[model samples]
Target chain A: METYIFYGIAIIALLVSFQKNRAKTRSALKKAWKSFENILPQLLTMVLLIGTLLVFADTALISKIVGKDSGWLGVLLAALIGSVTMIPPFVAFPTAAMLLRAGAGYMQIGAFVSTLMMVGVVTMPVEIQYFGKKLTFLRNLLAFVFSFAVAWVIQGVVG
Target chain B: MKKGKMILKRYRFALITMAAVGVLLLLQPQIGMKAIQNSTFQLQQMFFVIPPIFLLLGLLDVWVPKTTMVKYMGEGSGIKGILLSFLIGSAAAGPLYGAFPVAAVFMKKGIKFSNLMIFIGAWSTMKIPMFLFEMGSLGVKFALTRLAVDIPGILMIANTLQKMLTAKEVEEIYQKAETLLD
Candidate 1:
């Protein structure tokens, strides 16, 4: 079902892109390739980092930090770690799924995934380069706090 | 020295590739080969999947002119504009970086900074396609809960940031972009 939905959206997007006479599909493709090229180094680094983390970090290690019984301290710690770690959302979801299967709590997964996407401690340098330092810091700080709020809300709703 | 410079320029790509290999080997020689093989395969799959999507996105962006965007999302465009930007951004298919070019174009056309923040925040955090994926993998309740929490969180953060910066400051930034473009 999910695969079907994804393909459907992809098809629709392709059709939309092809609709207009002015659309420069070839140039757009070149630009997209260039974007990928620009990020290749960073992406390679991230893949290695994530691969290392998955290999070394086990359920026991994760549970010690974000186990269900660890309470708000665990939540805060998870949020902090997530804020500092930048993972693509596509990767983060499967990781959270794996952790959940390994006995991590919903709240912890929620906090981590939310912070992973929203907070940018790791990407702060890049973000600051793009958006000024002050704005970047404030955004990351607020996002870190809000990630915890998201976890708390999820706990309330799901628990 | 001129010959050296030419070689350096030509071999830059090879140098980076060799450095990446060296670092991987140095870190964990035992697993490095296996890791590289796996990562390469994964990267190949990602490239095949992601590039076309990004191309489609870029083409859609070009097709939808700046005038159309600004008409709906410009300064004092109000709640309607904010909502429209949010919906468009959340539905748009691509990474957060993809939003930058679109937002830059909108900013050039007088879209408010606060709303751009909202658009970007929601673009990354509140993607509907991502939500559907989550729903299928997780559950509808979980997806809905996340959507509920994230929507307001994105807005509130953007609003707070807006309060921190003055309208004049934002206008100044936009003017700078315009000047640079000119």
Candidate 2:
């Protein structure tokens, strides 16, 4: 049911993105292609790293580092892990769910999700090339700090 | 020799990154296999879906004039533009990285940098499917709180970053982009 709603929204967005506007859309496409071409190597590398992390990292060790009882230490560790590990938002949720089932806390999960979505340590090289180092660094730093705030807020509200 | 050097330099980062991945895989073969298995279907789906969508997005971006984006989503562009960009981004479903290419295109075409940040932020943070999934697992209130926090947070971050970035830097990027395009 919810999935249907999302699909409906996506279809509408796709349609809207297609409407009349030839010149600007063409320029945007060119830019998109340029960005895509530039980032292709970095993207592939990041994907491989993520795959490797998923395969090799010990979940038990991760859980211990950020598990329910570890408090702020856990949150920090979770955020750090999330910064380096890039997962699609969709995948992050289920992975968080599995972690929660395995005894991770709300704070840990919140930090993980927020950082996973916002901070891009893995993609930093590509991001820096495109946006410049200072701006990219500042944006990522702000996002990382903000993720902790988000986690705390979630903890207060839910717990 | 120069060509070889250029090739080596071009691939240096990729080679290092691959080596890092190989080391990680070697350290945990079982875990690596599980991660690959877990994400295989989704990754395959993404590979299939993204190119076509990006092509269309590219086509639209090129076809649509800058004025349209500005008119719809400019800075201090007011709440309407913000809302529209948010809605558009949220509605465009897929991985957060999927928005990167599109956002880069929008930035090149003179969309306000703040608005592009908002779009990308919302694209990653305010996903519709993920919201529903959260609602199922975590409850409606939990999902709603996340949405509430994310919307304002995205706006604030974008606005703050816009102020921090100088006009000179913006001009430099614009010039560089123009040269690249040419």
Best by lDDT: 1
- How many pairs of residues in model 2 come into backbone collision? 16
Q: Give the winner by TM-score.
A: 1
Give each prediction's root-mean-square deviation over alpha carbons: 5.6, 7.9
User: Across residues B1-182, which tens digit of lDDT does each residue of candidate 2 receive?
Assistant: 99889767766776886676556558877665565554453345445434444454454444444345545675567778777788767656556656766666666676677777788788777855456656545556666777888887888888888788898886675555455444
Per-residue lDDT tens digits for candidate 2, residues A64-145, read: 7776677999999899989998666544655565566556778888888888888988888767655678777888888898
Span of 10 residues, lowest total lDDT, candidate 2 chain B: B45-54
lDDT of each: 0.68, 0.67
**On residues A1-159, what C-alpha lDDT tens digit does candidate 1 reach at each position?**
444555567667666555644347556556656655654555555555444454456568767778777788888878887877766654565456556655677788788878877776766665554456667778778888898888998888874
lDDT of 1 by residue, B80-120 (tens): 98898787777665566566566666777777787888887
Q: Candidate 1, B119: how far from true, in Å?
A: 1.0
TM-score, cand. 2 vs. native: 0.63
How good is the docking of model 2, by CAPRI class?
acceptable
